[model samples]
Target: MAVAAFPDPDLDPSRWVPLRYLNFFRLVIAGLFLVAGSELQLGHEAPKVLVAVAFAYIAAVLTLGFPDAARRIGLDRLIMLQVVIDIAVLATIMWASGGYRSGIPVLMMVILAGAGLVAQGRAVLFFASLATVVVLAENSWRFFSGRSSADFLQVGFVCIGFFGIAIVARLLALRAKANESLATLRGVALAKQQAVNERIIRDMQDGVLVLGADGRVRQANPSAALLLGVDSLEGRLLAELDESFSDFRVRCASADGALQRMRASGKLLRCRAVGAGEDGEGGGGEGATLVYLTDFEEILQRMQQMKLAALGRLTASMAHEIRNPLSAVMQAAELLTEEKRADVQVRLVRIINDNARRIERMVRDVLALGRREEALPEALILAPFVASLIEESTLGGAAGRDVFRVEIPARATLGIDRAHLHQILDNLVANARRYCSGKPGSVRVFAVDAGGRTALHVLDDGPGIDAAERLRVFEPFFTTHPKGTGLGLYIARELAEANGATLELADNAPGAHFVLTGRTQP
Candidate 1:
């Protein structure tokens, strides 16, 4: 039985080249035989027969070795036919040139070994058997016709050698095939791993670049391309892209440290470079470096969120502890005010009551931070909602109806929790009313469609916020107003975010403008 046959050429493309190489080997051997035979006058006793056999052999090899002919006849059959032809033609040439004494049969060993390899050790012993039979028959015929003396022992040893070589060739071919299969499997696995790595690099938010010793980009992921403000980064010099990259590369190569630099595109990136090796050790001879870029703004935002989270936890715990003492202080102040005392005593009681009430409001706002109720959002028409909020704010006679102007589309809608929206608008409008001039249109409430969301803007005619104060206006317990608890805007923003909305202070020139951007529909 033969070992596993070579994989089909249609399935494994590597199979086709070896078969073509075998055919070419056969052609070369045939041509060499014709050339050597004619030059040496190999068949002096039967020159015409020798020449005719040689030409016919060459013609047969060419016809059978054609690529299309092999494909049409099928690979196994074609290989079998080629090996058989090799045995017959070579044996005939040996007979014409004084039989095995001419050393022509030695070439038969090469044919047998090659056949075993090409067919992946299949049917090799059969071809050896056929060659052995033909050689022995030729010896028998020569002895019987008195043309030459028979050496049966010599022929037997040669036949044995043929079988031995064929068997060894088969074993070698089997080992070769096994190794090739293992290598192919490893190659496939490596390719899959490479694809996964590429996908990870491509989808990463941080930019990554691989640079060679020449400071040129050998490979770059999509984020790297975007950060560099280029379409592609491969094969381009870092210095050519930007001077900052050159400096960054130099700084990183000298030592492992990050370079925080802003690019021409106005993006602040923190770049760090490391050797492309295990544990950031030196890589190959080319000295490759892996550069990473992170956005500075995002880093700052993350830090701010961490700080705020810690503050919330601290304030929530403190508010719980302060509530009981704060209530006691207010009751004591009220009891003291009931006594008929001096005018100075009355003024001191008033101050105590006012401060106690303010602390109570602050404690209430702080406690609200811990209770984040789930928002139930619904769509509300813009004009009527603002009109109703304005009416409620003015019912206390703090301002007249005409003091505030509502400039919203009648059909425009906003998506938010009903109570949450009312609270947000009330806080904004009240803040606007406190700051604006006491005149019509001094405090304006307007709405505009922003993409699929609606932005509700509350503008006042009061002095606009300072540039330095803009960033901290939404922070809890941070306010410029003396009487303000400062948690109103913070709580309002928290509620806005709970309903998938954003409240921000827009940079309007004349006055403080707060914009509440929310979904246009529920």
Candidate 2:
């Protein structure tokens, strides 16, 4: 049968531990032999030589045990050399103590077994054979010299026992090493999987929390911390953090893992609690609970956006039908204006034209929403771009182009679609012009660096937006002005996002401020 291969002890530091243990066993055996030689009548043939050989063996074992011995002599050669010394010294001791009859030859079994375990594979069989030959030679020499009786059968049995023990020890050692390697690999795989899971949970948008049976937090992700409005929730009691959490946990537990809702940081959160098991039984073996939190307001906004998208598509499909009749009404109003109608008739025709134009603008805005185009990004320097855009704005021409102020760094840049930027700026600048005092700096446009990004700010010197209307400012069909179409700001924000940008309302004390933050490099 083929022998199993094992790792080298020199390369695998942990395997060297067994070699140290083997050396310690040698020391113990040598010590016992020394004490026996001093006190006991071991044999009549050279008792003094027995004590001398024991002392020599002790010195050899101690010398071989130095830390650098393995590195200098090489591990395999070192172990082979130690086995040779053990056999030669033990055989000498046996010959002095009456050969095979003194029972000293039995110590060879321990030496062979230690060698087998420390140096596995074919080395084990080599140690076993070497010890058998040395002991048999010692027995033969003693009998031929007439110093002891012939005991070939006893010597043969000891040799057989040596081979049996060595083979068995070597096999068991190989099994143990194989199992250890498998365990190490499994541990590494489990650690990597745990790291990936932690990263996913940390970056997740929804909140995740782990709570012990005692209702103390065990782990919390960043999203959970933000949703709960706390710096950290780990190791803190749920009730201490907020009564809403305490009540939510109780309700989820009572309802047997049903979804629940609770108010946190003035926002409604959709919450669910589950145990560790696949079935989500609230009290698994660990008695721990996994809780998930989602923003109910965000869910509502998504539903509203779906409704608005559907409404926009429907209006777009009927836009042509509506505009055809509206065109006829506007043409008839124009003819009436040219005919020099009476005062009341002229007033009615003017109102008709104005209402018809408003409807046409509404249809055009709805169609634009339905035909949301993919953005084509390009690099744009902010200062020149803002200056040119302000000059082309409808309100800028009436208010005088110089009335708008631009403050951008010489190298400030943005990665956004040109047409998208033009539309967004037109809406914002028009709003600013309508509200701001007709002064050069009443409408200010500036850009600032923001963490490798660029933020373009547009502010007007007018009464700031009321807090109540701020929340609805970005909603479609919502407006504070009588003649304004509510879709302007909403469409502007949408266009910004289509180009990987964000349009946000900033808290400015004296005027309405809008900031568009986007990529700095293409």
Candidate 3:
């Protein structure tokens, strides 16, 4: 979260830094020319105007340029101008004092080295070549004017020196530019990859906790905070999150990677902790334990659903055998009522009827899953539909209907199949009636308009299913009731989806709650 401290990889050299080096070099070289001229006193025939011009050029470069403001004033061109002026001033001072014998060309060599350090590949060679031209022109004039000058032998040696300096300086400048560019690109790439990694970890639904060596939370995702029922856990001790996790953490420290359960608040969480390996970023678990937290039944429920989906076709194929036999058994049981049956025979017939009904429900659920029906939506006034459903179910002698309560907006509407919607409501109502205690408002129906959709909730006042069991409530053939065929919820969800709606189990502790969300009119 402290991302602001990360350094920017694409570094740019400060304009003042390079400019200070250039200006300081030029000023000092100009001063040396003046001092050397007075000390050597080698000037005899050359005019003093050239020395004055050189001094004026050096003064102009130093006084008029502000290196700190180089960004606004084109710093590269300014540096190039300084190089050109350095060449011209060096030539003027050499001609005015002593053209070939002044030993001032060594100073010119310093400028060449500085150019190689700061300038581009060709720029360094360009500066050195310009100096070569200036030196040749100044010495030629001295030779023609009958001033004390060296022969062709000395001139050839100086030309060779300038050639070698230009070639070597250009190569070094080229290499430096390549290395600097490579470093900058690598930095930018690293920053981008880090950003992507952070985004992925943040968006994950499973709780992620990073703990220090002392078992204090170093970093935690929002899911981790919610799983442990804490507002935040950045600096909290891991033992404080859940006392049940102490043994789990100890086992994890052994590096076995076994899953463990931790009971926190009213929920149970399945967790696994991983310590940093020897080659990991933490270098052998001094810090940074990656703990993954998830509800145990939730993970198991998902795995079961995946298995159910693959077996749905096979179950549907078996539905034909299951359906015909149940119908035959129910028919035979009804026909047997005409006989003079004994009391035990009556009980046996009733048992057959009940079991047949359960088998039929299970087969219907399989059919619904394997052959998914396409949705057919129609707009309907929501408040009136809910009122009618309540009235009809009550008049039909639905047990526990008297305890039902309703809350819905008057102007609500939904676009869905009426029959499919009714089926979903029937399942939820039956579920509520079976579970709600004999108390007022024990079964409540509420609808909320969420702009694009309406959420219809059915709540019951009873000991709610455990958090782990709640995750598998909608799974086929998964139920705690010995007489129940868990397909009621599975079929209900399928029917809801066939009408462009969704069925969901809501996490409402101390009570059971379900929601059926359907799209509303635009």
Candidate 4:
């Protein structure tokens, strides 16, 4: 036959009840009282026998009733009852067993010490005072009855020992309580700190992943799970999850080296996975790898946008430059064709020459769209730069300036490439002048210190762009006019972004409004 073993109760201090220990102590004390009672019954001491019987009965009551009492009235209340019982028992034993001659009066010290384990403050003082009064009364009674001087001295010593024990026990219990309180406060603070750290990690926009030593997924933040297209990643292994993400897992498992690769979505993503041992120390676990994913989608999109924009600008600039030469050629051909005195065969030659020059200019502007360049930048101020650009434009020149107006402030300065700013403003002003022609057309230029940056505005009084064409206006070769290259706004935006600024079309009363905003560095 096999014997069954009972499980031990949990003994964690925070979860422990002092009543359990108290009950155990009560049983031990009952056994002592029973033995003492049996001995007194066997002896011829009548008073001692009666005292022992009473103590035995009291001990039995404590052993049998304490558990139920503790449950009904709480441990703290039961402890107070136990203190009163101890005082009464001690006084009765002292009075019965030869007054002060009975050395048992000192037993109150043990009870006081035990009380310190469970009771405190007023309870401790109450019990201690009770024991003192009982001891003092017994000694006074013994002295009046002519008891021996040695017996009195012995009782006095016992009373002193009782007080000494009670004081020491009370101090020790107070210290223990302080230590426990400090420990609990520390635990609460640590838990709060950990929660904050977890929140920060989960709230990050970039994908973060942690892998176990066996190349299994350990943890993934919300951003990581979203990037990988999963609901949750608690139990899934890294290799078995997604085939598209398998390359990262395989590279991490091989232990060859840290791996970095670019993956494409609508735009490119820079994915980096590295082993845990960059400092040359082995991983704390085994083959764990840390993975980081940064989305470069916006960067690639902006690059494409810039290319189309530069092409537009090049075409527009070339077209404007070629227009002057083509016009002169056209006039010369017309003059030749009108001269009736000239040979009749030469008239066809002049007509062909006029059309050919027009065709050549169109072809040159179209071809200039494919050009690319990487130019260095420099520091430039906006207020003066706008003034210079307006001066250089045909409508802005001193002789032909009556058609347009320019306004600017003197305080706007920024760190930018001077030539790029000039090119952007020139294109904008030229576009406004062309659109507002034949209606007393005017272009207004001004700058304001907007927060930490500068805002430059170019407003024109002309026909405004329709809502449908506004979005596509920056696309390469998409133009409203037959002679326009349609690259001005696109190129201006590209150049502005390259210099860490932005060009945006603002809402205007009649004509187009262009605003360039850039950070001003001291």
Candidate 5:
């Protein structure tokens, strides 16, 4: 594995080029010190040898280019060599221009500052010691030779000032280094947090949208695109998807921050909006809105299940009261019909008997609802199970056997309770056969693949159900046929839910098509 790079200003190799440019400034300052002496005619002039050395150092810096070679030589050793060269060059210039007696020794301060910039820890103190020694040696020689009037006491304080510059420069450099490292760490942490948030948003079951204040979609997840039935959502207005979504824009404008439910993709959806407030695109203008959309049908279904549970408890209490009274009424009507009644009286008795039987059937269905429990689903072959269901639904029928066909893979299987599956198919197929008028091939049962799930469709050739009534077709006690108790479809839907499948009227055009979809076990 390769090692990762870290932000380290003190020991960083890239600082080499900058330090080299700083060295160039040192040469320029030295040249000024030399030229100043010559112009003042103080007999303190720079020799040809000192000028040649300064030019040679500059040439060496340019020839090396942008610190590439200096990096290869390693940081500690390279900075040490550069410090020695700076001391040597400055000491020579001082000697040529009049050291100790003149103010030429102050040029050594540049070398001290450069050492602090490039070196780490106490390395600057080391270079400062070297600078102090060179200047002190020059001063002592001048005093001994009677070439200067300044004493050792005054020169010593001037040497101490070099150490002051080194200490203060080192502190500033270290502070800058610490700040850079902190910024790098924060940047890495922010990036990781952003990545995690994106992953979670992509996988959420509910839809999420970031809408600009201009009403255009700035960002959207897959669920949002699917729910709105749009191929692409970016840059599209929310109200363009459907007329009902115009309410979404209105809600956002008011900033009510309340949950609302709307219809989309033929399903009910719960939506909520949150304001971002004038910084979404970082323009400091009005921010975008965050929209969350959840399927209200799921929440409604759960609430419906809870209501059904309460109803089951209530029905259990009144089951006997309802069944017994109806049974007694039927018996009395039968006795009256057998008393040699007239045609009108017999017809009245028949009506009472037929209605009493219908009530009895309804009672039985309600009793079944109370007994429903958690189902234990098992794998069953699709082809054989469907073949058997078609025969059983047609057997002993008053309308006689109607045409039906089965089309499914030989090895295809489904995970469901056999009885529940039978109930679902029986209700759908029986209803389809009735509408087909017992015509051969007019009633069809076929298998279809619905987005990786296995589905069975029961279709008829008769006039289909009206679109207005389709949504409420599975509701209990709702029926268009006078003889229908209306519980068959409701019971079928309950059975489908128990087995973790879905039964819904898929289409009403050409014919009424009901689809029973299940997860594939194989």
Candidate 6:
């Protein structure tokens, strides 16, 4: 079995360019030195100088030309070998040409510059110390061999000058690196803070909308879009998009922190504006304002539900307290009718009958609150059903002859309980007939198939509900007329909702319009 060779740990394969460039410059310099030495030697042969130049060329090729192949064959370790060989070649050239007086010691500065550019601080310092040792050793050797004192002084000054320049350059490079590291750290922290703020904004359940000073919607989260019944709210003005919300105005002062909540359409809307701080300005002035919107749709719904529950409880208590007196009045009227005085008894019976009927209507309205909704029956074709209801109600004198008119498409069908449906229609038609008494009015019932659902509309030409009264018309025991129970519309709405249908007051040309819409089954 053959053993696999391991990679060299000292060499970085990715960083070959700097090393290659350094070696190429080294080879050029060494070639110049070899030519100069040969010219200065005159008739003498400078074999050592020639040998040093050859070795420098070989070192350059080893460092630059074959980094990848050398790495594959475990010759990558020879990079350090190449550096050592270059240093040796410089030393040999110095010794061959007048030792310290050859000006070859100046090459140590090039070596130090290379080390600083390509290697770490400790590595560069080590190379600098090694070059210093070589210079001192060459000087001592020359001195022992009887060289002049002035030559040693010249070499010492040159070495000290090179060392001082190296120290200053290294200090500046280190300071620059420290500043860069701090800036990178600050950038990372700022990115994390922005991410956190985005997460908080997205996770909010309440509809949140951010607007600019020009009243254009800058940002809207998913909940906000859903609440506003829009696909996307960005780049739209609040007043332009929604007819209900308009003329939004608020003042924000950086000097004082205050928030105001505005109420509109029975819903509370909270808004806040934040002004720019002093540092936000280009020249240290205040910055732009950011507006935040918080919708209270859910809050308003809860309040309405609570009010309805309270009213339900009050009506239950009132019904119990009034039933006993109503029963006594009805019984007293029966007793008075049995008396023999015809004229007095006749007047008393009329008064008793009128009051008794009023009490009975009130009791019936209160009892509707306690009535449980029945299950839906099978689907019924709408045209025939609506026709039958019109004929029966008309014949029953609820709406007198020719008082009610109906128009229904023959193909329309609806899933509903026929009994409850009839009851709802009866109440509406009866209420219309009663209100239209002594007035030239007509009741109209119409039906159509709308998007796979059946829509039934009951319109009366008696009186239309005003905008102010429309909202309260559905409340129980809240009637516009003295004889009206006010429970008719409320019960109609409840029955419609129980059958998975919705009853709403629609805008009519002239009169009250009540529309019911629900899915139609085949």
Best candidate (score: TM-score): 1
Give a tens-digit lDDT track for model 1, residues 1-522. 011234344633444556667667777766776777767647765777777887887788778765566568877788888889889988888888788787766889888877777664448889999999999999898999999745899988989988888888778777877898999999999999989988998899999888887888888888888876778889999888877776775675544356555555567777878778834445323578888877777788997899699787757745754565576667757767686768756776766776677787887876665544667889989898888888888994645777888889988998888888888888899999898888978988889889988999999999989999999988776678877777889989998988889999988649999999999886
The backbone clash count of each candidate, in order, is 0, 0, 0, 1, 2, 0
Model 6 poorest 10 in a row by lDDT: 1-10
Query: Rank by TM-score, descending?
Result: 1, 2, 5, 3, 4, 6
Better of 1 and 6 by lDDT: 1
User: Over 4 Å off in model 2, which ranges?
Assistant: 1-11, 38-44, 254-264, 278-285, 311-522
Q: Report every candidate's CA lDDT.
A: 0.79, 0.79, 0.70, 0.64, 0.71, 0.64
Between prediction 3 and prediction 5, the one with superior TM-score is 5
The TM-score that candidate 5 achieves is 0.52
Q: What tens digits encode model 5's per-residue C-alpha lDDT throughout 390-480?
A: 7677785634444775668787777778777877778788788778756667777777677777787888887999979998898776677
What are the per-residue Cα lDDT tens digits for candidate 6 across 1-522? 011133235555223444556666676665566565566542133566566565565556444445455465444344455545556777677766666666666776776665455554465566666677787787788778786423667777877765665565556556656776788799899889889977886777656665655667767777566555677888888777654345444343333323334322333445445543433333212333444555555656886898699777757855764575577677768879687788878777776776677777777766665443455555878888877876786676643656767687777777877776887888877776665533333777789877888899888876687888988888776677766666778878877777788888888547888888887962
lDDT: worst 10-residue window of model 5: 1-10
TM-score, one value per model:
0.56, 0.55, 0.50, 0.44, 0.52, 0.41
Which parts of model 5 are misplaced by more than 4 Å?
A: 1-14, 17-43, 63-65, 100-106, 149-154, 242-249, 252-264, 277-285, 309-522
Clashing pairs in 4: 407-445
Expressed as tens digits, the lDDT of each residue in 481-501 for candidate 3 is 776766778778877776767
Better model by lDDT, 3 or 5?
Answer: 5
- Writing each residue's lDDT as its tens digit, candidate 4 over 1-522 gives 011122124322321244345445555554555566445332223456544656664554455343444456665666787667766765666565555545555557777887766676777777777787778776786678776323556666776777677778777877877788898899899889889978987998777677775657777789776665567876577656554456665554443323243232232345567666753235424666677655556556887898689657765766675666567666766766676765643765665565566557456545432322443556566666666666677645565566566555566687667766777778888788777753343767777878988888887788888888888877655688765655566667777877788888887657788888887762
